[model samples]
Target: MSDLILLRHRQIPDLNQLDVYRQHGGFEAFQKAVTTMNPYAVTDEVKDSGLRGRGGAGFPTGLKWTFIDTENWPHYVVANADESEPGTFKDREIMEGNPFQFLEGVALAAYAIEAAEAYVYLRGEFWQIADQLDRQISELEAAGLLGDKLFDTDYSLRIYTHLGAGAYICGEETALLESMEGKLGQPRLRPPFPPSYGLYGKPTVVNNVETLTNVPLIITRGADWYNSIGTEKSTGPKIFSLSGRVNKPGNYELPLGTTFRELIFEHGGGIPDGRQVKAIMAAGASSSLIIANDEALDTPMDYESVPNVGAQLGSASIIVIDDSVSIDWVLRKTLHFFSHESCGKCTPCREGTFWMKHIIDRVHQGEAAWSDVELLNEVALQIKGKCLCALGEFAIEAVTSGIQRFEPDFRAKVSESSDEDELLVESEKA
Candidate 1:
C-alpha cells in the first residue's frame, strides 16, 4: 500500500547525502534503539516483525540477533555485500542509490547486538562502491552518528568496509570470516556457528545487505505494521531482481506472496517480442529450473510457496527463460560458472563439478552421445549431498532440474547413436 521503504531514495532527491537523509528522518531509528530501548528489547521487536533474511537462507533476522553471545567481549557484525551470484544485483543498487538507509540498518543491528565494530565485506569488483561507502562511514562518524559515545550514551560503535578478492565462495558466512582473517576463502565446519564462534573466534552476526536494510523501518514502524504487508507466514515486502527475456528487466520490490505471473508480466513487462516463457529459474543460477506453466505462473513467490514448485525463493533472483531457449545451453552456462567459482575444498564438489562441466561442454558441442546426459545427471546427484559448502550443491541444481524439467532438450543435444558411433565421429574429426 505504501511506497518503498528500502528504496525510498527513489522518491526523495539527494537522499544519499547525510544532510538530506537526516531531513528525511534518517538515523532516527538507530538513535531510538540506542537511546530509548534496551538491546534485547530491540531484538524482540524484530522477532515480532516476522522479518526473514533476504540472503537466500530465509532465516529469521531477529532470531539470529538473539543468538549473539553476550559473554563475549567486542562482538562484530559483518554485512555480506558480495553480489557475485548471477542474476542477483539488488544489493549493489541499494548501496549505490539508497546508501545511508543501508548503513543505518547496519548501525541499528550493531546496537541491538551490542557490537563494538561492524564490517561491510564487499567483492573486489565493487571497489568504487566500497570507496563510496568508506567516505559515507567517515561522514557518519564525523556527524557523531557512528563513533564512540553516540547520542551522549556510553555505547560506542564503528563501521568498516573490507573487500574480498572477487571469490564467490566468500559469500558464505564462515568462508567470509576466513577471508576477513586473511586466510583462504572456504567454509568452516559447523557446530560452533557464527553466533558462538566467528570472526577472530568471537561471536559475530553475519547478515545480507537487503536483510539489514529492513531493520531501520522495522524499528521505526511497529511490528504489526510491517507484518500486515505480506502473507501470514511470509511478511513484509521483498525485492525481486528480474532478469532474462523480460522487456523491462530490473529490480521490482513487491510483497512476498506475489505470483510469478505478476513479477514477469506486470512488473517485468512480460517476455520480449511476445515470446512464451518456457521455464523459470526462480533464484538465479542456484535455483532449480521451474517449468513455466499455468500452475507455476500462478504459484505464489513466497519462501513457503516456492518450494511447492521444487525450488526455494533464494534471494528472489528470477530468470525468465523463453521457449526459444534450450535447457541444455542454460545448464552448460550455469555449470561453467559454478565449476569456476568452486573453492575446491571437497572432493565430491571439486571432482563432480569438473566432470559435469566436461560432459555438459561435450554435449553442448554436439560431440557426446545420449549416455553423457545420463552420466551428467548421475554426477550431479552424486554431488548434491556431499559438498564442503553450498557452492557444489548450488552447482548441480540447474543440471538436475534442467534434466528433470526439460529432458527433451538434453536428449536432442546429444547424439542418439551408441558410444562407438560418437567415438568414430570424434576420430573422423581428429
Candidate 2:
C-alpha cells in the first residue's frame, strides 16, 4: 500500500491549473460518473467502498447521500471549504493545490445525487481560494464538463463558490448552508438532517473538501479497489495534518491503521529539540487530551482504535505537543478560539465558551482558585450534548480533558496567586 493518496498529487506542479489537472486525469471521474454509471450505482459504489466523511463527524458518506429526501427535488451539494479547525489543514491543501480534482468530485456528487446545482462554501478568509475555484468552474463550463446537458447525459449542474463571513460555526454543514443562503452562521437543530432537508428546504449533501475529493477516485478506481486501501472499517487513505513540536510538522497521508508512533517519529521526524512527548491532541483541539505515554503513541490512528487511547481520530488532524508546552495554555488557546468564534445563537455555547475563556485566561495569568478549574471543567460538560451542533460538543472536549487528565497543571496555576487582593480582582473578572 502507498503512504499517500490525496497527498500523492503533490508532485504535479501547476496543480491548480485546469490544463495541468486535465493532463493528470483530473476530470476522468466526472466523465466516468456521468457517461457510464447511474446515480444509484455511484452511491452504491461509494457505499461498497466503505468511504466515510473526512470531516470531523466521520459519518458514512454514501449512507449520507442515500438518506437524502428524494421527495425534495433539485437537491444540492455544498462542498464545505471552511477549514477552520485548529490542527486541520488538509482540505486547504487539496483546494489550493489540487482544486480541479475537488471540483470533479463535486460534479460527480451532483450527478450522483441528481442535484441541479452545487455550492462551494469557503471561509471568508479564503477569498483567494474562492477566486481560483470560481475560475476553475468557469473553465469547466467552457469545456462542456459542467452546465446544461453535462457530458450529454441529460444532467445539468452549476457549482458556485460562496464566501462565508469568517465564522467557525459555518464549518458545520447546516450552518454553512445557512451562511451560503446569506443568513447569520448558526447551527440549526438536526433531526431534519441535511440529507432530508437543507439549503432552501432542498435535499442537500454537504461534504468536506477531502470527503468529496475521494469520490472521483473511488468512481474511477472501482469500489473494491478503493476499499482495499485502509482498514476494513476505515477503508481509505487519510491525510493526517501533523503540526506543533514535530521536526517535520505537515500533512502526512497514510492508511488508517497506521500507528501514531510511525506518524510522529518516522513520517514527522519525531519531536523537535529532542523534547519528550508530553501530550497528543489526537484530533486537533476538539479531542480529549491524551498523555503521550508509549501505549497512547503506539495506538493506531483509526476510528475504533483512537478512542481506546481516550481520544477521537477527528478529521485525522494529529497535533503533537512536547514537554515544553503546558496543557493549561493549550486549553486556554482553544477556549479563546471557541469563544471568539461562537455564533451567539444558543445559550450554552454562547455563554459557556466565553465563560471558559474568562476562567482559562485568569488561570493563565496566575489568578485562579483550585476550585475554579473544577468549575470550568463542569461548565464544559454542561454545554456538551445541549448545543445545536458538533462545534458546541467538540469545543469543550480539550478543556474538560485537560482539567480531568492533567489536574495538577491546572491546580498549580491557582497556587501561584499570591494575595487575597489578587483573588478579589479575579473574582470580579469572573
The lDDT of each candidate is 0.91, 0.86
Clashing pairs in 2: none
Worst 10 residues of 1 by lDDT: 420-429
**85-190 per-residue lDDT for model 2 (tens digits):** 8999999889888888889889888888999899999888999999988888999999998989977778899999988878888998878888888898888888
Which residue pairs collide in model 1, if any? none
Q: After superposition, how far is residue 216 of candidate 2 from its true place, in Å?
A: 1.1
Please report, as a residue range, the 10-residue window in candidate 2 with the lowest summed lDDT. Answer: 1-10
lDDT (C-alpha) at residue 41 in model 2: 94
Q: Estimate the lDDT of model 2.
A: 0.86
